[model samples]
Target: MEKNYFNLLQLPVVLPIDGSLLSLHYQQLQRQFHPDNYATAPDNEKAAILQQSASINAAYQTLKDPIKAAEYRLSLEGININEEQQTIHDSPFLMEQFMLREQLDDLEHAQNWDELTLFYDEMIERKNQIYAQLLEYINQSHWLMAKQQLYKLRYYAKLIEQIELLQEKQFNL
Candidate 1:
């Protein structure tokens, strides 16, 4: 069985957690076990704090991201959402992504920021809708649908990352 990150972080097993709560919990754990706080302690104590701090950081990252949290929960439920032999057979979703990529590729040099911002806003709205459906699936204990949405969300996340990199490159020019 997989270890429960929610328990490790002292958080409830729920999607759409309050970001501030996660941050607060992480900060509290960090302050308690940060190596700097054990500077004057023995070497063994420092090593222990370092290990604990690393574990806390891993738990924090898992809890803070909705997708990672979903993945962890699904894994615990005995569902492997791993893409080993799995393929996204959703044709409509793939087509939509293709069209979005087309738009991104066709972006002109002029007015790039405004155009990219509008496209990013559209992507954000769709991503939020995906998240809502993912939460509903989770709340209802529908692991299959949640897994499907999680896959889609991961794809969107990668594309959005590319968009952000493009923006950074343009901004730096």
Candidate 2:
């Protein structure tokens, strides 16, 4: 049986989880189950400790990021979010994405920090709005709506990363 990351991490299985508490639990688990502590154990026990350590690391990583945590939550509800196969057919949403991408492309070529900063702020606001919607959907068990919002969140996240990378490159130059 697959492990439920929330249960493993002693989390509440909710979106917008308490990140600080998650980290604390992860650290405590690591200290307790780290294979280094079992150095003198029998071979079978060492192997089991290794597996437990690996599971703790995996659970920590999955819960540390909101996107991954949300995806895991959906999976727990028997709803798989397959970005590759899911086609976002909402016309308004598609149009907004096209417009945002166009703006980002223009900003990338221009490399104007002022404009890029403004764009980044706008993207963050939009992403936050989507996140709020996603939170509500998840709380209400509106799985399909939450999935759709997650798709949009992925786009904004990538776009934000692009802006940050551009900023970093400019800083280096």
Candidate 3:
């Protein structure tokens, strides 16, 4: 039973997916296949439900995260990302990212929350800009550019995660 994450969530494969509806559908599916509800069922049926429950959970996660959703879409388009080829070939963007990371790494313990917020917002804006281009390229069937955009998004996503972790550490101190 091959299923795209969007299909499993019963939603269209597009940006700005409805989170609330996805949650509702996910919970309903969980309840339907919960092992407690099948205690008296046959052994094979129980195993099947367990597998389905796992698949449903994975699908829910895939559709919940924007970056993951983009990767899922690419997979649907028969684009297998070569995981080993992770670096972006765009030299200028790589330099910008390197500088951004260096700046983040240089943050002091006394870094202002407001300043951190601004930095976070700036990274998010960059990610969003790339995503907009990605959507355009995808719609136009520009496979290479779309894949490049995904790589860009992945970098930003990882950078954002680092910033968030740093923010938590700084704020807690």
Q: Largest lDDT belongs to which candidate? A: 2
lDDT of 1 by residue, 1-173 (tens): 53477776778888877789889988998998888889999998889889888888998887788888888878878889885976677999999999988888776345478899888888878888898898899899999998998888888887788788888878778
Name the lDDT of candidate 3.
0.84
Positional deviation of residue 77's Cα in model 3 after best superposition, in angstroms: 1.1
Residue 172 deviation, candidate 1, in Å?
2.8
Clashing pairs in 2: none
Q: How close is candidate 2 to the true structure, as a TM-score?
A: 0.95
lDDT of 3 by residue, 53-132 (tens): 99899998888887777777888888876668666789999999999988776664547677777889999999999999
- Residue 142, candidate 2: alpha-carbon lDDT: 96
Sort all candidates by lDDT, best to worst.
2, 3, 1
Model 2: residues with Cα > 4 Å off, grouped in runs:
none
Q: Against the true structure, candidate 1 has what lDDT? A: 0.83
CA deviation > 4 Å runs, candidate 3? 109-114
Better of 2 and 3 by TM-score: 2
Q: Comparing candidate 1 with candidate 3, which one achieves the higher lDDT?
A: 3
Clashing pairs in model 3, backbone N/Cα/C closer than 3 A: none
